[model samples]
Target: MAIGDWSSRMRGAEPCRPGTEKNKGVAVSPSPARRPSFREVFAVPEFRTLWVSYVLSAVGDRLALVALTLLVYDRSRSPFLAAVTFASGLVPYLVGGMFLSGLADRLPRRSVMVGCDLLRLLLVGAMLIPAVPLAAMIGLLYAVTLLQPPFDAARSASVREALEGERYPLAMAIMGSTTRVVLVAGSAAGGLVVALFSARPALAADAATFAVSALLIRFGVPARKAAASGEDQPSPLGQLTEGIRLVFGDPALRTLVGLGWLAAFYEVPEGIAAPYAGRLGGGAVAVGLLIAASQLGAAISTPLFTKKIGPLTRLTWMGPMAILACAILAVTVLRPNLVASMGIFALSNSFAMYQLAANTAFVERIPNEKRGQAFGLATAGLIVGQGIAFALAGAAAEVVPPSTVVALSGGIGAVIAGGLAIRWRGMSPAVGRHTARHLGREASLTGQTPIHAARSN
Candidate 1:
C-alpha cells in the first residue's frame, strides 16, 4: 500500500485491497481449539531475538545514563551541567520523533533498527576517548539518542508482523512488563557498575552491548522492504504531518494517544523523586526504594491484568484506573509518611493495564503499513509531554514544595483521564464484548482437560 493511502484508511474508507479488514477497531476472534499460547509468542524465533535485543539495549541505555551523569559531575563539578547531560537523553525525542520518525517507515524496519544500533555503538565508542572535550562528549550523547525513537518505532512495528491474532496482546504485555522490570534493575545495576569499576568501563560495556544488539537484529530478523512504494514520494516532514493528522482524526486513536500523553503528568513524581524523598527526611536509598516500588507495581500488574482480563474489559477499566491512580497520588499531598507514600505510588502504577489496553487498541485500529510512523508519533508524544511535565514540575518545586508540585501534576492527570473516560465509555461495549469472547475461547482451549473417549467411562 502507498503511504498517501493511509489517510483514507484512517478516514473510514473501505480497505483498499484484499485481506484488509475495515473497522479493525473491534478485537479479532480466533477459534477456541486454535488459540495460541502466550508462551508460544516467544517461540517465534524472530520475536524472541527482538525481545532479547530490546531488553539488552534498554539496559545498556539506562546504564549509560548513570555512567554519563557520574562522568560529567566528576569532570566539571557542576550539578547543573550533569543535569543538562541527563536531559539530553529525553529532549532529543521531540526533534527525532517529529522530523526523523518517517525514516522508520521509509526504510526497511530491520535496517532502521540495525543501523541505529551500529550508529549508537560508534558514538558511545567515541565518548571513551580521554582527549575528547566534555562539550564534545555531551554532543555525542545527544546525537546517540536522536536514533532512539526511530529504533523503537521500527521494533514496535515489527511486533505486529511477528505475532498474529490473540498473540499480539500477549506480546505487548510481555514487552511492557519486561521494560518496567528492566528499568528498575538496570538503573541500580548501572550505578553499581560505575561505582565498582569506573565510568569508562561502564560506557565501554554499553557500547559493546549496542554492537551485540546490531548483530542480533541483523542475523535474527528477516529482511523486508519499506512500507511506501511509488514514483512520487512525499517529503519526510509531509509524511510525519500526515501521520499526526491520521492519529488525531480517528476517534479510537485520538483517545488512545490522549491517554498516553496524560501519562506525562503521571511521570512527574519520578522527576521529583529526590526532592520528595528529601522532604520526607529520606536519602538516596529512599529515592531508590520509591522508584523501585513504582516500577514493581507496574511489572507485577501488567502481566496479571493481561492474563486475567480480556482486551474489551481492559478498555472499560483504562479511564477509571488512570483516574484512580492520579487521584490516589494527589492524596499523597497530605504529607504522608515514607511508607505510606511508597505504597500509594505503587498502587498508582498498578494501573499500567490502562496503557496496555490502549496500545492493543492502537495496534488494532492502525494499518500495518503505517505502524512504524504511528508508533513513532505515539512514542514521541509521550516523551515530549513527559519531558515538559518533568521540566515544569522540577521548576515549580523551586518555589513551591516538591510534594505540592507532584500532587498538582496528579490532579491535572486526573482531569485528563476523566475526559478520556467520558469520551471512550460509549465505544467500549461492542469492542469489549468481542474481545472478551475471543479471550474466553482461548482460555477454555488452554485449560480444557484431555479425554480418552466415553468408552473408558
Candidate 2:
C-alpha cells in the first residue's frame, strides 16, 4: 500500500463530534475521550515528518557531543580543556532560555528551526578548519549551543500543533522513549565512529545531519504566524519577561513547571555513576550498565504509561511514582551489589512518566503563540537544575560516600514532590485564562480568531 493509504487505514474514519447538553441554558462540556494509540498518533502526516526530523537531529546531537569531546582532548592534550568543551554544550541552555528563546516566539517557528539548523551546520563546518584557533573554535561551538533553546522550543511547539488533543500526551511519551533509545545508541555509535575514523569525519557527518534536518523541517512542516505575544512585546527582553510571568503567575502552570524541577534531582545517581560503580566492586562496564539500566527503565515505562493510565489519573501518578523512586534510591545507602544497584537506578528512572505528564499538562494550558517560550522556559529549568544536581552531588561525594549523596538527593526530591502534589490536586489540563487572554488579544489585533478547539488525533 502507498504510505498515505497506510496512514489513512491506521487512523480509521473521522471521529464523531462529542454530544453536548444544556443545563439551565448553559452548554455542558463533554467528558474527556480516551488517549489515542501510537499507530493512530503516527498517522498524523506532519507529526510523522516532525518525528523523523527530531529523531535524526537528536541522534546526531548526541554523536556530536561524543565526537567533539574526544576532539578537544586529542588536540589540547588537556583534560581541563576537554572537560570545559564538554561543559560548553550544556551552559548555553541558560543563556538561550533567558535571552535567545524569545526568538522562537517572535519569529515564525519553521523559520526559527530552519535557521538554527543552518547556523549549526556552519558552526560545525568551521570546527573542521585546521587553521581555526582553539579559542575561536570553542567560541563557535558556544554560538552553536546558544541556538538550542529556540530550536527546541520550535520543535516542541511544532509537535504540539501536529498531534492534537489526547494524542499530545502520547506523542510526548513516544518522544521521551525515543530520547532514551537514541542516547544509548548514539553514544555507542559515536564512540565507535571516533575510534575508527577520528573526530573529523564524525563532525562532518554531524554537519550533514544538520543540513538534512533543515531541509526536512523547511519542506515538510507548514508555515505558521509568530505569536501575538511576540508582536505585543516591544523587544525580545519584553517577550522573555512576559513568558516568565505567564508561566509563574498562573497557579496551574506554576505547579506543572515545578514538576520538571522536581524530577531533576533524580539525575544525581546517573551523575555519580562512576564513583558509585567503583564502590560496588565493578569497573567501567559496571558504570555503563548502571547508566543503561536507568534509561532502559524509562524506555520500558513510557509506552505503558498512556496504555494503562487515564489522562487525569496519569497526572496524579506523577507524585506517587516520584515518591516511590526516591524511597528506593534512599534505600541504596545499604550499599547494594552491582545487580541491586542497577535495579535501584532503573526503579528511579521508571518514574520518568512524571516528566511526560508534566509536559502534556503544560502544553495543554499554553496558547499556540506562547508555547515556544513556555517550553523554552521549562526546558531551561530542567537543564540547569540537572547540571547543578550533578555538580553538587559530585562535590558532596568528596565529603561523603557516593551512595550517601545519592540517598540525600533522593530524600530531597521526595520532599519537593510531596509538597507539589498538594498543589497539583487542583490543576487541570484544560486551557486556562492566560491562554484565553492570548487568543483574545490575538483576535483583536489580527482581526481574525485563530484559536480553535483542540481535536483528537
Clashes of each: 1, 0
What lDDT does model 1 reach? 0.75
Tens-place lDDT per residue, model 1, 1-457, is: 0000011122212332212223323343323334456679889998999999988898988889888988999999999999988888577877787777777778898999999999999999999998789999899999988988788888887877777655776778788878888878888988999899988888888898899999999999999888665666668878887788778777767887887677777667788899989999999999998888887887788777876765556766888987876777897779888898888888888875678777776766766666677777778778767778888898899999888887888898899889988887755543422544543453355452221111100
Q: CA lDDT of 170 in candidate 1? A: 74
True-structure RMSD, every candidate: 7.0, 8.3
**How accurate locally is residue 438 in candidate 1, as Cα lDDT from 0 to 100?**
42
Alpha-carbon local distance difference test for all models: 0.75, 0.72
Candidate 1 similarity to native, TM-score: 0.88
* lDDT top scorer: 1
Q: How many clashing pairs does model 1 include? A: 1
**lDDT at position 79, candidate 2:** 88
